[model samples]
Target: MDYDSVRTVDTAVADALIGERERQEETLAMIASENHVSEAVLEAQGSVLTNKYAEGYPGERYYAGCAYADEIEQLAIDRATELWGAEHVNVQPHSGTQANQAVYHAMLDPGDKILSLELTHGGHLSHGHPANFTGQMYTVEQYEVDPETGRIDYDGLAELAESFGPDIIVSGYSAYPRAVDWERIQAAADAVDAYHLADIAHITGLVAAGVHPSPVGIADFVTGSTHKTIRAGRGGIVMCDAEYADEIDQAVFPGGQGGPLMHNVAGKAVGFKEALTPEFEAYAQAVVDNAETLGETLVDHGLSLVSGGTDTHLVLVDLRDSHPDLSGGDAEDALTEAGIILNGNTVPGETRSPFDPSGIRAGTAGLTTRGFDGAAMEEVGDLIYRVVDNHDDEAVIEEVGERVLELCADHPLYAE
Candidate 1:
């Protein structure tokens, strides 16, 4: 973790790099969309591939001296294909949002209708929030969860699909905590003669490890991040049937982005190879188990959980019932000060602004990757509840922060 080479060139940047590593070592990363990548992935991403310009897919590059680039990118595509069982895989979208953009670009025309989950109800901005390009470029309609259950109202979504007649239906989520019935969503798409884009950005590892149901063979297209649930460094992936292969490939390359981040592709290749090991399967299951333990512990402390629990790596907690006066923003700031890093998220039936929402979201991917089991996760949950319950008290925050440092020392990250 020493940035000696960087130090020789510029001490300022080197210090920031070293300090960032030390920060991760001390704090817990419980944010649902984040996880720790392996040292192998780190090295791969920091490799010399960054200097190359591979403007196209493997075997068809626009630049010379791309033989190695072709090899690495091909490896990444192949590994992703094997991982998700897709007829086609593109490993060069740079981000999950771009991967999604490629799909929209390939099949959709301007002003086409898109039906997706409402953002505050566990959806993403890429799913057509007014602030994003998708909203401006297309006609969008949103569905929501069953207010009483805190889960997706599949029947309601299907009904909406029928009425909206969307060109493409978007499934998957950012803050939702339940297992998605991919077939149900696909059926809705089929009934409307629409394409279905299942964005499994948050649950990529869970789906690949068989801990969560996959949308690959069922849905028309699947997109995700190489990080998050997976140990990949930082990149995006798109999977589709053979019929749409060329269209997707074109959309991802010149249509969306100019050049692929070869170092990131190398990272994806290495991380995907690591994910194929038996150890990763155990790790993925542990992520879900740890989330369940955390949720149970929170419930025991009188917290209300969305969907009452989780079937994935993250859980969404509605703080309204337990601490009506406490804003999620205040709770998040206090938790960060206490070395527990998670986000204040909007709940399904949110009654407050998105910025200072009514809930907090936490995940177990980072902790489980650091070797946290059910018992440890429960204790972490206890610590979280303590902080939320006593957010105004600096003494309690300080005590919990000390315990957090002790726990981090016990479960060190990037120790290699």
Candidate 2:
């Protein structure tokens, strides 16, 4: 993985690149939205297609030299179609946020009402947070998970929808660990004649492998990140019925972005190809199994898990009950120092600031990609607890760091 060409041109940049690779190899990646793409996917993303300007969809590019770009983009669309069974798939949004942006651009007028989950209750900013364009452009209303159970209250959401009469309802989440009820959400949207956009950015691969219930057929529009559980590198996709295909295409191009990132499209093609295999199905299942084990291990150590447990590849630990004085940010810092990388996240009914919330979110998608099993994840859970329990103890952190190095060595990632 040496950046020899980069080193020849700029040694400083090369050093940083090599350092990042080392960093991934040394630590555990438990951030719910992060994952490692395969080397083949990496090669495709770093290819010469990056130089091409494919501003339009296949067979209709504004640029002249787009024959190969068309082929790659079409391949990505085809593979994504097979993976999710969508009538239309747009692989051009630069990120998941942009994917959501395209849907909004295609369907909603300015000040159109949006009903979505609250950001602190496991929802994403693109859903309706004030900082994002969706919030500014739309009339945003938010719902929440039941504070007592840490799960979405579908009945409550239905009441909110009936009262608000929103134009769209956004499902799917960033930190929520339980499976989403797309049908329930869709019903609510249907009652109000509202559109439903399910942002499956965190569980794209799980849905693709049938490990999680897919929202493709149920929701009016579905969007996801290519690099999370899917391992398709950095990009976003929008999927919907053929009826809305042209609107989505236009929205993603002239409406939001200019030229497509053809190299990332190539990466999507290759990674989606990889995901269509039996092995990938097994990996997706293992990811969930590992997460369950991790959650159980953490519970055994007296930590609190949101919703009691998880049925997906991530777990949310609310530190409020276990360590009332310790903030999630402090736990995150200690875990990082101990070579286990995860993020501090907000839980339902959060009382603290977003920067230093009450929960830490961990996922097994990256670890499972590196061939980690339930046993390995259980040990990882133990290691995490050690740091959380003794965050300020220098000796404990040093010991946990050494154990993390051992685990990293045992399950090496991106090995040459």
Candidate 3:
């Protein structure tokens, strides 16, 4: 679609929005958990559904005049089930964190024991960060990746599960590079009779495309974000066995949130329909291929990759060896100056704080969606190396930025 030509009626906001669109067209966006949705998704998100106040599920809605809203929501639910093969689907959670919270509210009590990945190691704060509601409400026992291999130690996790005997076992990550062994995780949870939840926020599209293994059939509950690789709107979804449908719905509505965002749900319906297309499957595979190629290029540039490499759309660069004196924050700023956008992430067992970690997280979803391939990724890796090597050279940074703009122009994100 010609996103550049899509005019906004409000002139004051239009200029700023156009500039932002131009910026996206001129930079390399490698943020691991971000992606560009299609114009169809955006159209659905900005539709008249936003004016409605559908405070409940289809047929049981609290507001009147929900006939059309019910149809849209039902279609969304059907598409979600067909796309992921889930027995039941909840399309109402505002975010992935809310989805997780809904599961906790439905299945666990306050002070219940929970086993999740350590945030610094790869898990998200919503899983069990000390300051988050999860940590305050539940006793969180965290597992970490093996320092030697930079991968999850399943045996170690099993041992911890046996010892901790958590009430819930959460399997997912925000930065871990390798594929998770869902069966092993399920067994670990089963050994202790704990409820198992899989948060595939980052890899949901990969799963739908069969590039990554699906956790739906094995996990008791599965939660994910619609944006990341799904290339949808900004929202979350929860899927589970049909028997738990009532509990999950109640938790999301009365327990955590109130009225649902019908507009985003409409966008999700369009996104889910797009995901079921053959083009999306190819796009998903390309994202993984681009990530692996980028990781290899980074290694060729003398950087160590966490988990040795990626099996999905993201690669975590362990900068300890390449730039012993550089912090993740410094690398972030240096790369931003060169027109490359990504986030600084903490590697496993890194002593540095989250704000200044030992690693950087980059991904292929956005770039691939922008039409970049393996060749573009190799050049991107070189740009990254140059920026890090010439951290203090403004002229060099400007030159690299121009090159990035040239690349973006060659492969426009949205046609005009």
Candidate 4:
């Protein structure tokens, strides 16, 4: 139970580790795809279940003494299924990318066509980034966001689907701030006879809590990470209709991954149970409210936001008007120096490279989980403006970093 005793070895390494924890505690984590897991989830993740080698599903494990492992894994699957109304749930994939890969391996042949959102326009790399295995093995047709509105161009997607006739259509993103019209996407996929896949990795917690619309029943396959807003351990899950159960399970086990991480699965079970609580629903709603407030504050500060605003926990800030001289990379570095952590993101139709994008992505999941409200967000917004506006001001950065630590102390993420 003593993480300090377990993680701390040599004095230097222990000091560094302690410092890292202190940094996470003091800084606001605004990454859209990140969250702080509860102590219960952490306990489950660090449990003795990690020693087990449950290579297959319950009752068919490759190793002995898997009774507890089987129970935990089944509990995770049942909870995931109940939470999402999924007919079948596979809680074995190591990460979201792995879950997507398993689905691809299960359903598609080599060189099959996949229609997905463009990477620069808020899509995940596993959805078909050229450098990823999905893109290298499959023929990919990318749909894009509308240049003017910065929203999904559904009409353009339909046009692409008609022309390309892809075998699968992926609908989701890592940084998109708007709610997708799942029905429209499903209709488009249906029209082209393409399988619909929704990778709701960013908004899975919101969806489960009813703060965002669920894609469980609409999409043929639903994929998500347990950690994001779900506040679970680091792992991925796949859910689908009962018809695809056998194929999906086989693909995940013998096809894509080896043994399942039972300890993480236990953490997932705990997370899912928490998500089912009313308190978790309130937390999910708080994430959206905090994000909206943050986005409005950014806009009021003269920063351009992609899609003008957000309907979810994340915001993509386009800095072309506010900081024409600065790139997203510059903003990220400056903000990190100020103890406000976030990522530089590429806006749709960005001319800059991905490494130094034109926009920055921020989220409210971590802050909201730490109980930060609208007022706190407004203050955080001012800090962000200061950092972005005065990237070279070491004094200002140090001052804001101190303020960040103060704010973090006021609303500590974990009770001491």
Better of 1 and 3 by lDDT: 1
TM-score of 1: 0.99
- For residues 356-400, could you state the per-residue lDDT of candidate 3 as single tens digits? 999899999999998888898889988988888787899999999
lDDT of 1 by residue, 1-416 (tens): 89999999999999999999988999999999999999999999999999999898787889999999999888888888878899999999999999999999999999999999999899999999999999999999999999999889999989999999999999999999999999999999999999999999999999999999999999999999999998896989999999999999999989999999999999999999999889999999999999999999999999999899999999999999999999889999999999999999999889999999999999999999989899889999999999999999999999999999999999999764
Off by over 4 Å in 3: 1-12
Candidate 2 error regions (>4 Å): none
Clashing pairs in 4: none
- Give the per-residue lDDT of model 4 (tens digit) for 156-246: 9999999999999999899789999998999999999999999998888999999899989999999999999888778899999999999
Model 1 segments more than 4 A misplaced:
none
* Model 3: how far residue 368 lies from native, Å: 0.6
lDDT of 2 by residue, 1-416 (tens): 89999999999999999999999999999998899999999999999998899888899988798989998898999999999999999999999999999999999999999999999999999999999998889999999999889899999999999999999999999989999999999999999999999999999999999999999989999999999999996899999999999999999999999998999999999999999999999999999999999999999999999999999999999999999999999999999999999999999889899999999999999999999988888999999999999999999999999999999999999876
| Cα-based RMSD of candidate 3 | 2.0
Going through the candidates in the order shown, the clash numbers are 0, 0, 0, 0
Model 1, residue 381: distance off in Å is 0.4
Candidate 2 residue pairs in clash (backbone atoms < 3 Å): none
Clashes (candidate 3): 0
The C-alpha TM-scores of every prediction are 0.99, 0.99, 0.97, 0.98
